[model samples]
Target: MPNSTSILSPIDVERIRKEFPILHQQVNGRDLVYFDNAATSQKPAYVIQALTDYYQGYNANIHRGIHTLAERATKAYEATRLTAQQFINAASEQEIIFTRGVTESINLVASSYGRAFLREGDEIILSGLEHHSNIVPWQMVAAEKKAILKIIPVTDEGELDLDGYKKLLTSKTKIIAVNHASNSLGTINPVKEIIQLAHQLGAVVLIDGAQAGAHLPIDVQKMDCDFYCLSSHKMYGPTGTGILYGKKELLEKMPPYQGGGEMIKEVTFEKTTYNDLPYKFEAGTPNIADVIAFKFAMDFITELGKENIAAHEHDLLLYATQQILKLPAVKLVGTATQKVSVLSFRVEGIHHFDIGQMLDARGIAVRTGHHCTQPLMDRYGIEGTVRASFSVYNTKAEIDQLIEGLERIINFMK
Candidate 1:
């Protein structure tokens, strides 16, 4: 249960929980206690209804039609872009480009901007805490362009070593890409400071906001990052949809990521001319239904207010942490002072996979693996950890159930 006294005001979690239809189901014999929110959040009724509404009512390709359905679809699709622009406080609608998810968003920037601006021997600074999606794209870009990759070390506490990061910056540093929050560890990074420091050396900063999008407040203008990527699935929206926000000037200067129907202003065997800003990057038919549904998800968040959502999750995190700490032989990983709602831990003599399976039997879903951060796992000298992430809909009762499950697992295993 939450403490009677707290700094942050509590949200009506019970009321919010009712909005998520999936939570009402039984996974095993028991009611589902979903803790795998970091992997992907469960969709709310609003979002699911929005998806159904789009497919049943007005399903058509956007941006290239004169008919009623086409215009309706196009209008609905563009509405999401506007919400996303306002959601992140982007300077212009032209700066927001739709993509599959954060993976494609990062790949777009790496392929286009890296190839265009990065020269041989230029340096790209990454952190040890980066997800594989964040790491691999830059590595590919670096290898192809003969650019060098520099890394900021993560401390034992799962926080990035800012002192070490400062050392890596020099005239050769062309780009600095890192996450706003660590997906595996949930550490809230000092991105504003990072962007400021990187700018002093003329290095562009790209923040992977996959984990931060749902849990934290985002303002691209305030953060002053060159690029920011967010995944809709992580933000209580549909899967296979996301947005990449870049400064208009940078986006205008960089080449298009994909070449296809809508991306061309005019094309010929002799010469091809690209479309303007966002349309230049978004080619072919996008995931229109999911993208349309994503707007409702954002609307849900906006209606509840991000501050209230964060407060609710933080209370859950604190409650889970306190209860989990009471159990024996459990070692918490990523004890950062600031974090979102993720709690990762490893038992002394138990495999994380077994722990996950045992918990699943009791209807408590959790993530168990290196969490696509194999490099970060290697840093901590552990194979993997059991990760239980919270959301606005989670409650103390569900967390108590988790603690009870963990206790049972421990006593039975031992």
Candidate 2:
């Protein structure tokens, strides 16, 4: 069963904000109103404490030493793997392979799985809404293997064209990769339906859950996606650490992504054998401190409740969307009925960069660029958008600050 409560209590946004130390600071001589959560979230006190505790308590290399510090460190690190397995509801901890974030996770699959399976004339399906991490890796594989790349179209409203997706499937299609929720547009693609359709055509699916990991309830088993990826920093954890979850059978068959250290069972000049499941993919020392601290990040979301977080963020999205649309010549980029708390838009005759700068001066931080989805920006015939993404700690008061900031920018610049 999913982690939710029948009795949905309203989120105490003020109390939640208190957990984040960064929220208490002043940026540009004004109270910080952080809406750039889609890029990375501000860490809470406990999460930071987790890092300090690990280094101060038991900082040692894992899985090799018989010493006490090594055992303690190893236990904490592997415990996070199990926590992540339950966080996303992966079938087993063996399926969770820690990596350098979503970019490296996708590259791991494209390099290992693509090398093992993808062949000449095979087709790989992707979406127009995918982040460049999802796009460029497969593009490299397609180019190398002489395979073809197909895209599921996006509508003017920024929703995926399900009908367009159906039209693209063929026997030659070997793989399909898409984001669980688009980072740029916050369009929640019908991932389960997409996975089912791809399965019927005998193609495996990979869902980039970098954005969804923080905002949405994810069950890899329920979604039945062949692979999933996450960025720890996007979920309020430390940077340089993330997860790549694949089915045990699939991971068993795929070759190791990197060599040396814990990834190998035994090594010699004559021959080398890989370790089992996750260890096979996790190379080198791994992001030990961040991985240990990530447990607190997982605990933070779980303790607050995923449904509660979604509810709070949804309210922020609605309020921000309503207030921003009331401004002159302002157009919302994505109008997807089903979305998380990401609000991306642009005012007519104002460059997105200028809007970003003006808002920053008001102590309102937001993401302004293609949001690593340049192709998605190109689809709308715009250079980029001003993206204000919300999180559980955000409040309606912050949204008002954003609205006021935008209103002043439009009025002064025009």
Lowest lDDT 10-mer window, candidate 1?
1-10
User: Which parts of model 2 are misplaced by more than 4 Å?
Assistant: 1-7
Q: lDDT of model 2 at residue 319?
A: 90
Model 1: residue 359 alpha-carbon error in angstroms:
0.3
Q: How accurate is candidate 2 locally (lDDT)?
A: 0.93
Model 1 residue 43 CA deviation in Å: 0.4
Model 2 clashing-pair count: 0
In model 2, pairs of residues that clash are none
Residue ranges of candidate 1 with Cα displaced over 4 Å: 1-9
The residue pairs in collision within model 1 are: none
Candidate RMSDs in order: 2.9, 2.0
Instruction: Give the Cα RMSD of candidate 1.
Output: 2.9
lDDT of 2 by residue, 261-327 (tens): 8999999999999998889998899899999989899888887788888988998899988899899
TM-scores of the models, in the order given: 0.97, 0.98
